[model samples]
Target chain A: MARLTLDRTRQQALSVSVATGAYGISFGALSVAAGLDVWQTCALSLLVFSGGSQFAFVGVIGAGGGAGAAVATSAFLGLRNGFYGVGLAPVLRPMRGWRKAWAAQVTIDESTAVALAQPAEDLPARRAGFWWTGVGVFVAWNAITLLGALLGSRIGDPADWGLDAAAAAAFLALVWPRLAHRRARAVAAASSLLALALTPVAPPGVPVLAAALVAIAAGWGHPRPEEVPE
Target chain B: MSAYAWMWVAIVAAGVLSWATKHAGHSVPESWLENPRVHRIAAFVTVALLSALVAVQTFASGRSLVVDARVAALAVAAVLLWRRAPFIVVVVAAAGVAAGLRALGWG
Candidate 1:
């Protein structure tokens, strides 16, 4: 029984990992097309490793901002991942010494979501899923990023071929699966609307930050009586 | 900002900030995670964050707001998602619709 559970967990992790990792190609190609060099592009993937932040950083650079401004903006956007780590602490096995750092480094969106989605009975399996997905995504993302960066130089223009759309498409692919409830739907709608409204007024990353604030405000009040069932 | 002359101090700063933010939550006391207030805050924060991302992707182009094929495709995707279409199909259909529109010069 344990072996079967482990197998299932591994499969789940691999699937999520592949899906998340494949999107790195878009990031690599787009970042290079946005005017970054191969080394800078790879460094973003290796060090930043967060898609939203990477996009923000490159977007800022593309728009001719100083590197300092771009980095600050990306850092602001990446703060949410820290909150995910806090939420996952209870379910994640307690680790001491070096393992804790490893766990922290790998605590990303896909891993957190997959681990949290696991059944309570499959705690060990869930842990495996989290770790495997994180490691798999990290490896695949860097590798694919390298390939995309190299290929991007040869391609005339990524935008002309719609390569630029891949990142947004990939994000939608991940997001569509989670809109299973009314609250989620409502939150998504509200946040998207807020962002759309703010985009013209704010800097590159500011809209995202604004949308997050809106969602936080919406979450302040508990779901209405009709929204929750006894 | 020449490629080589661009100061890396900002990059290093950003990396430090990103790492700190990403790691801060893990260091929070365990009790906070279990607190209902914190849970509510986190939930709302997530919604807002996602909304913001979706909005920017759909509407913003550099410094301006413009509706185009991508926005149209996103509208289609939202409808499909609401209809409970499979995720893969939703993405493919939306991208196809947008790409086709652009190719046809309607976007």
Candidate 2:
């Protein structure tokens, strides 16, 4: 599966980084409007480093929910990053000490997704994808967050720019290539519908978490096609 | 504690939880995770969850389903992606369509 060139991976990683990073402008503005000062909003991006969770935090707060709910929601949304870390652990193995600590900080959605999209055997490309994507997103997201926070509501509606769609578009692009398998397609459909149906009732992150169960459930039935040996 | 005080507490708590989750994955035994079952779940969970995120982001507004330009953009983006267009093209086309629709007040 080592099909993606190092150069190609770098290009993909960088492009997605900039696109998703620019979307951070919207997050910064929203967080401030939600009553977080510029520094606190910046701190969230600096410290949390997970865009979905960061947005989930401000969204809850903007709605006047208590900080407890906000934290809980964001934390739950962030649980996906942990799973990403797990999936990539083998590929990113042998990390130690401060390097490991730093890696933990940046083991985010875009990084892991880009890295995993690499062929499993292309270790160098995988590592390159992970590090470049993570670092690229970090620098760009933080820099833009600072800019957006300072500008505040003057940035207008980031949503209207279709940035809200941009993030989704990036993720969809990642999933698009992997949809070749029947099981993958089935699981995607089931999970998406589950999440949609639950969106009206379940709290923000719960639907996604519940949808994750579909993967484990599918595993029981499909029996790992790769293991069967063609 | 005021909500502000709790906010501080919660932020620290969330950071710790997130960090721990990252580290724990590294420490997990390789053999334990090597099960193909584990691999399948790990791989597909991302796809499912990501699509789920997109769904909620584009269509849901506080427990209610609403169709808007975001959804329309997503559909166009899907077409671009399926045709193997480059990343920027897919995103730009998607956003352009959504923006065009909104400008016309269709979304």
Candidate 3:
């Protein structure tokens, strides 16, 4: 039974990694269209290694926002990765020094989700799930990103190839799973409207930052039962 | 600095900041992250940011808000997502719809 469970965990991790990694093509194409050269685009994947932050960075820069705004936007999008690290530390305990640092680097949404979904007492399975998903996604995401950047550069006007629309779709796909609760839905609606309103008045990065305030306001109050329906 | 130089800085800075944020969580006290308020805010912030990106990417073109091929493409993408299509399929469909619309000069 122990061996059977381990195999199941590995299977889950590999599937999740492939599904998540496939999205890297869109990121690569979008980043290149946003005006990063192929090498810079690949570098973003290698170093930053967060899909949402990398996309937001390109989105801000592609829209002509200053470097400060781009960095700020990307950084804000990266906050959840930190939270993931906190959540995973206990499950994958005994990590120290280089191992701890490496674990932190791989502590992303998929890894956290997969790790936490394992049977609570099954530390070995949880660790396997986390490492497999994290490393698998890292390799697949970077390799696919490079391919997309190469194709994106040769594709001429991004709009002509529909890459811009694909970027929006990618964002929508990401947030869709998270919008299970009423409060989240309300926040998403308000944030999008505020962002739309500010798009014309404020600079590119400012609107997204402003939209974040809606969430902060919604969340600052004491947590209610309905706050976390998931 | 030239735009090229600035971009390189932004890329490196963003990467460093990302790693720092991820690392901080591991080092911070568990109680700090366990706070319900912090958790709620983080969850909501993610939804808000992604939704905002979708709106901006689909509707905004520089200082002006324009309706173009992207809108139609996103509409199609939404249906595919609603029906539970795979991620890559949804993306490819959106791109195809937009490309088709632009080719026909209807967007």
Q: Highest DockQ, which number? A: 2
Report the Cα lDDT for candidate 3. 0.77
- Per-residue lDDT tens digits for candidate 1, residues A1-230, read 88987776676566556655666777788888878778878888777777778888888887888787788779877876786676566567476556776677677666765565455467787687678877888898888788888887564433434333433554554455445568767777887877777777876667776765665565567766333110
The candidate, 2 or 3, that scores higher on DockQ is 2
Docking class for candidate 3: acceptable
Off by over 4 Å in 2: A1-4, A222-224, A227-230, B1-7
Question: Candidate 1 — which pairs collide?
Answer: none
Q: Model 3 off-target regions past 4 Å?
A: A1-44, A50-141, A144-159, B1-14, B25-28, B80-89
Model 3 shows how many backbone clashes?
Answer: 0
* Candidate 1 ranges beyond 4 A from true positions: A1-37, A58-65, A87-100, A106-133, A156-181, A224-230, B1-10
Residue-level lDDT of model 3, residues B32-84, one tens digit each, is 65777666665566567667778988989876899999999999988998898
- Choose 1 or 3, whichever is better by lDDT: 3
Sort candidate 1 into its docking category.
Answer: acceptable
TM-score of chain A of each: 0.72, 0.90, 0.69
Which of candidates 2 and 3 is the stronger one according to lDDT? 2
Cand 1, B chain, TM: 0.80
